[model samples]
Every structure is written in structure tokens, then in C-alpha cells.
Target: MITGYVIARKPMYDFSDVIIGRNSLLRIEDKYYHGIDRLNWIDVESRFKQSAIPENLLNVYTDLEASEQDLTGIKVLKKYDEAVVLMSLDEEMTLKNEILVIASNKLNQIKGHGIATVQTITWLGYDIVLLGGWSLIRHAIFENRQMSLLKVIALNSFGLLDNEEQADDFLKQYNKLADLDSVDPLLDNSSYGVDCIRVGVL
Candidate 1:
């Protein structure tokens, strides 16, 4: 029943013709992270552990916010780089028969902003698709035909494997599309990317 949306914006800044300003990049990063943190707190408190929000997840989000501030203080020398902002909400309550009024209200806030939409496709499988913006041009999940199952594996963090052999067994299902250039053979056929990694565990 985990679900949410993400928004990405390109910061508008002007710098000298030859070099881009560091302060501009910092400002954009600050705004982006701030938005993400705000959405995370709202979602966690209102849904995930509504009965009793865990202090650990709260603390981790706080720490991440602080780190983003530190990142803003650093100087940047690049001009034409892409910056991304993501916000997500996951709740078990949605599985219940009763619909969550509060969660619905919060979702309405993101309407028409070109954020990515997340939804359940099966009892234990979920699908996340980007839309309405440049972000949609890229596929967040793997593109291979057999690797469609990899989406489920990645969403569950490869839960099917307890040891290397088990992981290899799972990988065997998608051997045709696996990347073989890596030193580790198991990684050869995997398509998990940096964006899918969960930031905080609750």
C-alpha cells in the first residue's frame, strides 16, 4: 500500500558567461531538499506509523536535512548539470477497507505538478512511473523484457536471496539481459539504479 509522488524542478540562475556561480547551485539544492524533507515528515506522521510515529525515522530525516544544508555551503564549479528533487509517501493504512481522508487531501496538493505516480499492481508488487515532465523521458525501471521481474525484486530489496547462491538463482531467471562487464557476476544482469534506493528505513 506504499504510494506517493515526486517533483523535480530546474533552478533558474544567472552567472558569468564563462563560469556558473556556486551560490546559485547551493540555493537550488537547499530549496529542493527542504521540499523533500517537508513532504517526508508529513507523510510519515500522517500515515506510515500514524498510531505512533517512530522516533528513529524522524531522527534520520532530520539528519538528512542537516546534511543537505552542509552540501549547500560547498562551492560548485559546474554550470550545466541536472539537479533533481524527489518526494514520496508510503502507508500501510491504505490497505485497510476504510479510505484515509487525510492522505487523500495531501495527495491533492500535488495534482498537476508533473510528479511521478506510484501505485500497486498486485498484492505484493508495485509500479512507479514518471510523468508529465522531462523526467518522464527516462525509464526508472529496467528496460529488458525478462527483467520486468527485477522490478519486484528491487522494490523488495532482493528479499528472495539469503545467500549468494539464492541471489544467483534469482539472477538466472534474467540472465539474457544482465550486465556482464562487472567484476561481480551477480551484478552483471541487475538494473537497479541509484534513484530506487530507499533513504530512510522505518
Candidate 2:
């Protein structure tokens, strides 16, 4: 099974057809690739089934002490935290520009302190929504010593078309997705990412 920590997941349609020639996105270790490029959906599903979800990370961090260096550094920035998980649990559908930005914006809208960021991690396996934002937010509350069950770190998943005819029709109707006036999802998600891993250290 592939192993890695999740950071953030985004919705909306990109050039999956043109770029990777498949619908599912997968990240193995630190590299992102189309799931079909390496393995079929069945294998992907089985792997995820065997792989640990973000919620399971709590067991690893519980009772562990974090040092200052663990909170900041190049290694910390690019490194994956087994506890800091991100997931996309929807079919790859074309999104209206505004629609995709909503989930990524949640962190910036609320994280009043610290460096927050966002990254895309695709959940190509099953229908499980495991701990969506709770995994990260729980860490946040644990850091502040005001622990509760409110999961604030947001994640998003969008629907995608499996049929070539549907995708072609979508492209025709949309006509220039890039030029279509829409908020950039990445621009707003930077800080969200920072806050996500921040809790892992705490």
C-alpha cells in the first residue's frame, strides 16, 4: 500500500483528461500522479482500505512531546505528518469558480494566528469521509488546551465525469475554463495548509 500524509484536498475540474488521461489523483510518498497511471481503481481501493486514514493518526501523536524545531524548518514544511491528513472524497466534477474556493478559504477566514497553507491530496479509493477536518482541528484545540470535538480544518471533494462524451460536452459548454472569471483556489489555501500541520507538532 502507498504511504504518505495528507495536507489538503480541493474540488473542481482541471486538465485530468489532457494531463494524466484519467480521473483519479493519487499521491504516493510526496509525489502526485494520476492513480490510473500506476494502478487500477481496484488496486487503489484495496490500498486505501489497508492504508491508515487521518483519524488513525491521533493514536500516534497522543502523549508524544513535540520540540520547537519540529514546528518550523524546511523539512517540516515539505515533510508529511502521518497525523496531518487531507482527503478529497468526491467524483471529479467541473466546479463553478466560486464553488471550489469555499472549502480552502475556511482556514484563512478563521486561523487568526500562525502560518497556514493548503495542498491538494486526492482520495481516489472508497466512500469513506474519515474525520474530514476534525483530525486537524482536534489537534488545534489540543494545542490551545481547549479541547472539543469541533473539526475545523476543512476539506473538499468534487464530482468528475467518467465518460469521454460527458467530458467533451462539458468542455464545449464551459469553453475556456482558465479564462472563466473565478477565484483561484490555491491563493486562498496557502495559510490553511500551514495550520493543518501546525497541530501535528503540538
Candidate 2 ranges beyond 4 A from true positions = 1-46, 51-80, 83-105, 110-202
Across 84-195, the per-residue lDDT of candidate 2 in tens digits comes to 2322222221121111111112232332222333544333321110111212111111112221212211112211112222323322222232134221112222322322
TM-score of each: 0.17, 0.18
Single out the weakest 10-residue window by summed lDDT for candidate 1. Answer: 77-86
lDDT of 1 by residue, 1-202 (tens): 1222222122222111212333322122122111111112233334334545345445444433343242221111111111111122233322211111011121222321222224322221112211111110012121112334444343333121212223333444334333543212232222321111111111
For model 1, what is the alpha-carbon lDDT of residue 74?
13
Displacement of the residue 97 alpha carbon in candidate 1, Å: 24
lDDT of every model, 2 decimals = 0.24, 0.23
RMSD of model 2, in Å? 18.7
RMSD of each: 18.2, 18.7
